[model samples]
Target: MTTKNVRPKFLNLFRIHLPVTGVVSFAHRVSGAVLVLSLPVVVFLFALSLHSEQGFERVSEILQCGWVRLLSLLVLWALFSHLFSGVRFLLLDLDIGMRLAAARASAWLVLALAALVLIALLMGVLL
Candidate 1:
């Protein structure tokens, strides 16, 4: 008699748990993608703003909308997340924080720092 296969044929992503480091690494990749994708739009907006007084005012008006401000905040958060996580990754490459505990702590620190930067930016913008 042969034993039956017990392996799952499909993955349930929602049921899978990742460590803090894993989450931070994944966020790093996602944030990088977001920043890359947003670059063209940012360049276009910049060029438009420089075209003339009308163009500058139009860009300003578009940026002043509540939804646009929220989106800008998200992009800003992505930028910080990518920057902090990148530095963490570079430190990891240098064998700093190679231990499991240190790695985990660094991962948490990266996340916390990025969030703190976002919060500070929001406060500065709103106040």
Candidate 2:
């Protein structure tokens, strides 16, 4: 077999484990994409409500529904995760947590911060 084909197969034979920082960095991109995709729907709904007084009332009532409230909570969680991770990346740009161990720890710390912020928001403590 040619070396090119053999190299790929050999690499695949081993289970590759990514460090936490790599995982967080990849997820940050994905979450940004999620935000981009979700933005239009969210903005459309907001615009629909703001177009008139009655439309505003209608949207307000719909928001009080359990499912709508749940979906809103989830969107808030996604927003927090993306925002916090972006801050971590900005810190990395400033020569912070570039070491393997520190990068991993910061990655986990950012994840924890996101979760804590979300939970606090859900509990009405932050709002």
Candidate 3:
């Protein structure tokens, strides 16, 4: 086969381990994408809840479901992840945390901050 036409028969993603910073960067993009895609649904739900009393009750009832609450928690994580990572990127843009160690540390901090937010939210709803 010509080199140009050749492709690996098996691409092994699991075999290659990403660094913590790399994983954080990947998650940042993923969370942003999730936020963009979920925005429309959130807006629709908000509009529905505000349109009428019956609509508000229906929306509240749906939110009371366990699975919906779980999903909402996931969405909350995505939001916090996106927010924290975005701020991290902004700092990088301004020449902050440009060192390898600082970058890695900040990545961990961002992930930790997102997790904290998720935990706080879950506790609020569960307790």
TM-scores of all candidate predictions against the true structure: 0.93, 0.78, 0.90
Model 2, stretches more than 4 Å misplaced?
1-17, 125-127
How far residue 58's Cα lies from its native spot in candidate 1, in Å, is 0.6
Which one wins on TM-score?
Answer: 1
- The stretch of ten residues in a row with the least summed lDDT in candidate 1 is 68-77
State residue 70's C-alpha deviation in candidate 1, in Å: 1.2
Q: For each candidate, how many residue pairs have backbone atoms clashing (under 3 Å)? A: 0, 0, 0
lDDT of 3 by residue, 1-127 (tens): 6557577789899897998889889999899888888899899899999999999999999899999887788788999999999999999999999999999999999989999999888788779
The C-alpha stretches of model 3 lying farther than 4 A from their native spots are: 1-10
The lDDT, on a scale of 0 to 1, for candidate 1 is 0.95
Q: Which pairs of residues have clashing backbones in candidate 3?
A: none
Ordered from best to worst lDDT, the candidate numbers read 1, 3, 2
Q: Estimate, for each residue in 18-88, the C-alpha lDDT of model 1 and write its tens digit.
A: 99999999999999998999899899999999999999999999999999899898899999999999999
What Cα-based lDDT does every candidate model obtain?
0.95, 0.82, 0.91
**Residue 53 CA displacement from its true place in model 1, Å:** 1.1
Task: Output the worst ten-in-a-row residue range by lDDT, candidate 2.
Answer: 5-14
TM-score (C-alpha) between model 1 and the true structure: 0.93
